[model samples]
Target: MEFANEPIFQWMSQFAYQPGMVYAGLIAMMALSAVGFPLPEEVTLISVGILAFMGAHPAHFPPPYEGAPVVNVHTAAIIAFTAVVASDTLIYVIGRVFGRKLLYHPRVHKFFPEHMMKRVEEWTHKYGAYACGIFRFTPGLRFPGHLACGMLRYPVWKFLVIDGIAALISVPTQIYLLAHYGEPILKYLRQFKLVLFGIIGLLVIYFVAKKIHQRWAARAASR
Candidate 1:
């Protein structure tokens, strides 16, 4: 995939000239995501990875940005890792401070639907602090899941250890791999973008059908 032709890359490239701004933006995105921002942190991470790749291969970018300072891949990875852990910890703190009350708050409740909240609770009940890893891996569940961990009053050290390990395994590795092998990966993504979209669409339909089936079963049981 030509970096210049990709609109996401084009938009992010504008910040390559000011690496500090890029880092700040990434931290802000991660923090917002922790508080249930509609955008996923993965999008920001992937964008950072692509930006790092472009920085390493400035010639691949168009003019103006071509001469800009590079966004160091390692530095970006460290910043991303730190930002993710810190933001997630903030969610944990909110849960700790407000306890269950935060969950019932009108604004907060809207972000976490009942079914999803049930799933988070189930995972926590089953796995204990280890469930923090599950929440870290699961995109939609992260915010509420982390909050639940805090609400349960799991040890701060345990939460940090578990979440940090998960972040270490996922966050920096993604940026590093993309920085090193982004061209081929992007090429494969471009080629299979339609296939990926189809798979995602099918998954959505399956989940919706399952939810309807579950509700119907509950209604029948009540009758």
Candidate 2:
């Protein structure tokens, strides 16, 4: 609903106004988003849903032109799902082929860092194949977790199965929900965004406090 006034609304509306540009753009952006680019995949899907609600096809695109392709809920979901899986698989392969050596590279470490990689390494060892599914739900953890899974030599078939299952649960849900309930869902998402950020901030504070306490305790014990 807010897209009516926003710049992105104007930008995406151009694509939405066209009969087929929505699908092409969504597939491309979704692929980029899955690979950890800053592109907002979920927001784009929701916009596609709204476009579906408004009938993305031109007003003249009814009747005899019904056979012609246009952006719709089903097509959007399928394309998004496939794009997500493909991009994620590509990242997994990059990690597998390059292994720990890539993860340790200074340029890569600037994004993935040694600490995050170590945490992901522990998680992979603890959870084995299931960690792939776990990482699918975790945004910041995905790059490192998937990479760690490969560096740790997790089975490729198992990685695909787990990641695919997680994608099934996450991908279609966003597109269909927005398509069916655009305004209310966006409102809820806006509110949920604040709450989610607050929660993450509190978790960060708690962990830092806990680490400081542990360090102090260790010093006292040494004395």
Candidate 3:
């Protein structure tokens, strides 16, 4: 835990001030996580959060298509959405390439519980690669999801297309919210006021609900 928060990690914080560097980092970081490194994506995202506050965009351009001197958060998110999609897609392919070897490694195998891996395989087999979107938000399960798609032989073109659509939904919205309350977020955190708890709480609820659904389905399958 301490290692993850050390000067090394803080140094990664420098990506916040550099737009090209940050996007590159985001791609590389997500790819690394998607490739099974287990560096916390949330922590990488928080750097972007601080950068967003600093008026730095982690994305390439973000969108609106309006002609003017410039666009705002929405535009920036739109522009960067494509990059986000590409990053995850490449990671998915990398996962497919190394899925079996990674699965055999004791550490990587731990990321996927034996039974859960079976469930992911079954689900992806039935539902196809679109499951990536559903599983992408899942922190621990993400790599497994990619592997499952690969194992199930989900079509690559379809997977990439669906991943892009999902990125469109996920990346921009996250960036926008980070920008919206950038200063207040920093101020509150400094003061320990923490109103962002509401947003984080909602995401937790979403995760818990998904977990519950997965568990219930698993139990039913056993029955």
**TM-score against truth, every candidate:** 0.79, 0.70, 0.59
**TM-score: the better of candidates 1 and 2:** 1
Per-residue alpha-carbon lDDT of candidate 3 for residues 1-223, written as tens digits (9 for 90 to 100)? 2222334334533444456656666656766655545454665555565555444332332222323122244444654565556656665676677767765465555444577777777767676767888766666666678766665556788887776677666666667767666655555554542456566677668756755665566566557
How far is 48's C-alpha from truth in model 2 (Å)? 2.3
Candidate 3: residue pairs that collide: 61-76, 62-75, 62-76, 62-77, 62-79, 63-75, 63-76
Candidate achieving higher TM-score, 1 or 3: 1
lDDT of each: 0.81, 0.70, 0.59
Q: Which runs of model 2 end up more than 4 angstroms from their true locations? A: 1-14, 56-69, 186-223
Off by over 4 Å in 1: 1-12, 62-67, 189-223
Best by lDDT: 1
- Number of the candidate with higher lDDT, 2 or 3: 2
* lDDT by residue (tens digit), candidate 2, 2-108: 53444433444444445477888877887666655543466677677866654543442232344455457888888888887887888888889998888777555
Candidate order by lDDT, decreasing, is 1, 2, 3
In candidate 3, clashing pairs total 7
Candidate 3 is scored at a TM of 0.59
lDDT of 3: 0.59
Task: Residues 1-223, candidate 1: write the lDDT tens digits.
Answer: 4636766557666665568888989889988877766566777787788778877766666537335676788999999999999989999999999999888675566545678889999999999999988899897789899999999999999999999999999899988888788898777766786797687688668756654675566556547
